[model samples]
Each structure stands twice: as structure tokens, then as C-alpha cells.
Target: MPRRTGWRVCSVPGCPEFSDRGGKCDDHRREAEQRRGTARQRGYGREHETRFRPAVLARDPICVCPGCPQCSDPDSACARPSEHADHWPLSKRDLIERGLDHNDPKRGRGLCGLCHASSTAREQPGTFGLH
Candidate 1:
């Protein structure tokens, strides 16, 4: 007979998801994590999530990848619904040090899931600080 280890399902009513990390499923866990992020991850405070992020989202309702190398053709650009409100050119660290509100989303840019993933992976992965 094989030895047994136990994992539990999410505590949310009717949820069948399971995880070894906690009582919540991965989705719920991630949701809670986002809500409980450190100051920096949560963009320093309420202003970032409540004010800045919403404003940016409203300003750029769709992705603006103008057929660049990472995107498609200018004539037929990927104007997908933006999933991220990113700090332009500057990274999160840069913004934190210089102050998150200094620009008020001036350089903010909207990006789709694909664009956001590519940009973050390229800028934040193994070769970080190399650029």
C-alpha cells in the first residue's frame, strides 16, 4: 500500500477545487493573494488601484500595440481589449523609487494579455537588469 498525504478542496461553497497550499483553490488563492499583496505589488496603496488604475483603464479601453514587431500590422493592428494598465517605458521598480504618482499615468499604456505577458517576460525574466 502507498503512503498518503492529504490536500484539501476550496472552502468556498460548491467549489470543488483542491490545493496543498491552503483551503482555497488556485483561483481563489490567487484572488486573495492579489488582495493581500505587499505595498509595492498593490502599487503602494489604494490610490493606485482605485484612482490611477481605473483612470488608465478608462483612458485606454483597448490595446494600442501599433503593428510593431511584438504586434501585428499597422493596417490591422491588435486592438484587443486591454488587460493591463502598465507604466510606460519605466518598470515598477523605477516608478516606486521615483514615486508612483509622479506621472499620473502620463506614460501609461494599455496592453492585451499577449502583449503584457511578452513585455513582462522579456523585461523581468532571467536576463533582468541586462537591458
Candidate 2:
């Protein structure tokens, strides 16, 4: 049946850790714990981190934002190192609706934090009718 919550030995066989947080002991929290509602719940799991993220980073090592902080000129390049792998369409809402496929090589853009934030903000429905 269900193991009552409190304190117990680690679920891992022959392990010695324990916790009251859940079934898993302290050491296994990162691997065993699942956030209530987020991309993880929606299928963005360890596979994405272990495989998809690295592949994406390797594919595009630089931010591809165009005229990022300001669009004064179309040819401007941010050239900042990519700190985030952003969706090509640049909307997480759309990405969720479209179902995130971390494996889709062409679906993302390597973006710096500033550029990614700016682009995402611009995609909102009220920014200069950009939606």
C-alpha cells in the first residue's frame, strides 16, 4: 500500500538517507522530485536536459537576436553568448500550444537573456500591435 509520510530510509536499495519531504531521501530529491505544474509536468524531463539542451547549445553557440535592446537598425547584432535556448517563434504560450519538441533542431534560437526577454516581451499582444 502507500507508505505513510514522515521519516524513512531512502527508497534506494541499500541506501542510508532519509527525509520527511516524500518517499525519496535527500540525495534523490533532485532526480525523484517533480514540481507540481510546469514544463517538467508537461514532458520536459531529464532527457531534454541530458540530450536535447546540449545538442541545441552545440548547434548554436551564440545569441541570434537582431537589433535586441533597441531596433534602431535592422543589421545590428547582439552577438552576446547564448544563455537561453529560445523558441524560433519566441513565445512560450505558442510553444506550449504547439507542444515543445526539444528534439526539433530548427524550432529554437540560441538567445542571450536580454534579447530573449526583449523578444518575448515584444510578442505580447499590446506591444505596437506586434501580436
Number of the top-ranking candidate, with lDDT as the measure: 1
**Cα displacement (Å) at residue 77, model 2:** 1.6
Error of 2 at 82 (Å): 0.3
**Model 1, C-alpha of 65: deviation from truth (Å):** 2.3
TM-score for each predicted model, relative to the true structure: 0.56, 0.52
Segments of candidate 2 deviating more than 4 angstroms: 1-39, 70-74, 90-102, 124-131
Q: Write the per-residue lDDT of candidate 1 for residues 12-52, one digit (tens) a residue.
A: 78998887765678898777666676656544567667766
Model 1 residue 122 lDDT? 65
CA lDDT of each candidate?
Answer: 0.70, 0.66
Best TM-score among the predictions, by candidate number: 1
Among all windows of 10 consecutive residues in model 1, the one with the lowest summed lDDT is: 122-131
